[model samples]
Target: MSDSPSSWPDLATLRDRIDDIDRQLQVLINQRAECAQQVAQSKMAAEGDDTHFYRPEREAQVLRQIMERNQGPLSSEEIARLFREIMSSCLALERPIKVAYLGPEGTFTQQAALKHFGHGAISVPMTAIDEVFREVEAGAVDYGVVPVENSTEGVISHTLDSFMDSSLQICGEVVLRIHQHLMVGENSRPDKISTIYSHASSLAQCRKWLDAHYPHAERVAMPSNAEAARKVKGEWHSAAIAGDMAAELYGLTRLAEKIEDTPDNSTRFLIIGRQEVPPSGDDKTSLMVSMRNQPGALFEVLDPFHRHGVDMTRIESRPSHTGVWNYVFFIDFKGHTASSNVQQVLQDIGEKAADLKILGAYPRGVL
Candidate 1:
């Protein structure tokens, strides 16, 4: 009954103060959401116009500003994620979004989808990249998540090829740092493992580690890393290379962590939707072009970017499928197509190349 200042504060009083703060927060959040509802209504009145639904550029600028001014125990990434959820909730107030990603559940691509869409989104798992695209194109899903490139292994050709025919636009992107774990069932012994299974890319990424440890074990490839984890239930002698989330989902024990060949191995995923996204201040545009199978065709394709002082971030060539000698080039430029310089470069490239298609422009993924 001393009521000393150092005595632990009364539990009921603290709870009441917390409740008051919560009530204020609720009121402010509701006010902000009411503004979102009004924006949605104005958008609907525009008829066939989508300007009010979302603004990627504005969102990116806002996140950058938050990160710049952030001073806290939480990192910029954590702060950005919290804001992303708030923005996602606001967008949901306008309309619920459906997203599709390659999966049977617990795949890395699924994680990327959730990161981009937030937990409020309706996420559907498709079996393949093309399936995700098909769903997006058919309006079965509002967006699709597909892996475009990996740091160690280069591009996913199937994903690039799928873009050749799809009309979907790239609205956003997410980069996930891949950490491979050597997982086994609870009863399994790491030293006694005889075989390992994983997706081809995962296997390749961890090849050196596997060779050093399980030199004699048979390495098998599966459709996905998640499948590999699922296949190792009762076999004490078998292990799988998978992500930490997959291991937890499959109830597998981690024998080793960060088993990838490189410390910085990451995969970039594209967010495909029907609507074009406004420039996110920091944005990247992707395009594919087929040039005449002749000397300097590559130079002709890229010269405009240099002449216009545009930065070319990535350029890869794949077989055109027209013949043995033909090739198609996929390029990633550091600007949006809506910009004047980028527009001029695209116009010049189109006139020079045999074929040119702007895949989509999207916000650059921040690591």
Candidate 2:
């Protein structure tokens, strides 16, 4: 390992070596894919037509192991990402999966879906989170991805509420680091930009940055960042605040990148589907509980978790649609429902709550 250029192989020699490595990689990848096909065949032989090709827990475990064992020139996350696509393509060769996400295209939800399921899986865009759930429930798509919360913007109430009426299970989670940019189309006037368009959340996220840069501009909230990017395509005096995906998709130039007030802004998305995901060692369980409108009702519901040593990660309250209960609490805790401690905690909470709904236990986000 010499730092000197003289000790390095010549350009042609290095390229030839790279070509040899690429050939080896291709052969190994095909071998892995063939193994996956054989695994599918084995399952189909045993389970007949009901064989499920995608296993969220299994995939999560594989990715985690890949990251843990990696000692490479590539970062762990980068290495895991490469393996994710490899596994995704292998899974697709067995049976291609379909994912529905809230989108008009180029939105973060779509990005999350692609990040979690990989580009190998087909992604369908829907108008709303409810529609995403509906499509997964109706068997139109194999899975759905919906935004659960943002680090800067807090929880998405619509997504939490959707779980109350839907029977879909949380199969996995994806965490995407968000980077908002001020973009303008080729036809737009960047110098005299008079109006800015974005989703309400994006506008809020970049409020401080916009105030510092374009305080005089009128802000218009669209249904989505994608729609906002679409709107500025033909406008000479307008810019859109959106992510890189939207800008690239709409062929817009980013005038100001990473414009969000918070430097580490990110969003977490949930994968929903008809089938339940088994324990992946590292897991989280979400629960919707309605406690009796009485003194210490919340404490009573939470005390069991403390006693059982289950780590509660997040808690949010939403007004109950039913007149019988005043409100419902959405709780997320670390650990799978199948674990003995989690089972005990849930049993204890079940006794104290007016209504209890275990949304699903799913693998924690790996990237």
Candidate 3:
């Protein structure tokens, strides 16, 4: 350590350099903010009083470009997050947007909301998924974020059914890596875990881990993981299973971490809003198709996508509410509705299916 003292900076010298760099960064950041404000003014001048300041498609493109050009000590998500906050601040300067997510705070949906909209957004916690949908439908919030599917647990049926009742369009999507942890409050008896609490899905997710570790412990299901965390604080002989966000919020200690059965467990969330997003270069379109009850109905509905060379990403079927509405399928595929081939595919599928509704076309998750 002493040998390279001549070429290396002393502690004081390094501190001084850091201070100078920070000052320069602060100045540049303010300059960027000023430019963003000017952009707002220009948009107002051109689009009048009813200008839409937040464009999910445009934001996705910017984040994608930033990620693509990054050559850093930080990961792409880190860089994109830094930019997200900057954009959040700039968007606030123009006009702040409200985001509604399924939460009581400290839920994964809340984390996803902050991830997509940044900390500057006014994110409200809704009691249920339908509440989030209603908030967006009533224009109470600018957008809503809800879980569509999880890698390990499969599709979120509630979210899919919400689309059937709501007119909101899908504007963007975010995929969050889920890490469920076993946590205990400060006064909890770690050795005497008589009961464990978590959401039903979360409990199912960590079933094997629980079976091996706390097989004799009483497994209780709650409304949400966050609620479990909240309850664990008052129960001395209990523990809660949740994520880092909930643990931090409830001041709980982690007894076990990332206990999900799958190593790469993740959940896909959709951003729903009133506005229709124009095509970003890379986009995915979601649609709902109700097929007639017949032998080849499923194949007839999907055959059009194959014939048009339209790439299908996912397809999930839910039971129809009515007799004629035999099979309801939620389909996600590449390309926008505006594209000719996609239009042709839709036309073909419309003929085959009893009913077809284009849910929305949106930019693919970039970060």
Q: lDDT order of candidates, best first?
A: 2, 3, 1
Give the runs in model 3 whose Cα sits over 4 Å from its true position. 1-7, 151-155, 179-203, 206-264
Cα distance off (Å), candidate 1, residue 85: 1.7
Q: Write the per-residue lDDT of candidate 2 for residues 226-293, one digit (tens) a residue.
A: 99999999889999999988999999998989999988788889999988889999999999999768
Give the winner by lDDT: 2
The collision pairs in model 2 are none
lDDT of each: 0.86, 0.91, 0.90
124-210, model 1: which lDDT tens digit per residue?
899888999999999887889998887665548988888877888888888888899999998887888898999998999999999
Candidate number with greatest TM-score = 2
TM-score of each: 0.76, 0.80, 0.78
Give the per-residue lDDT of model 3 (tens digit) for 8-84: 77889999999999999899988988988888888899999767789888898999999999999998889999999
List clash counts for every candidate, in order: 0, 0, 0
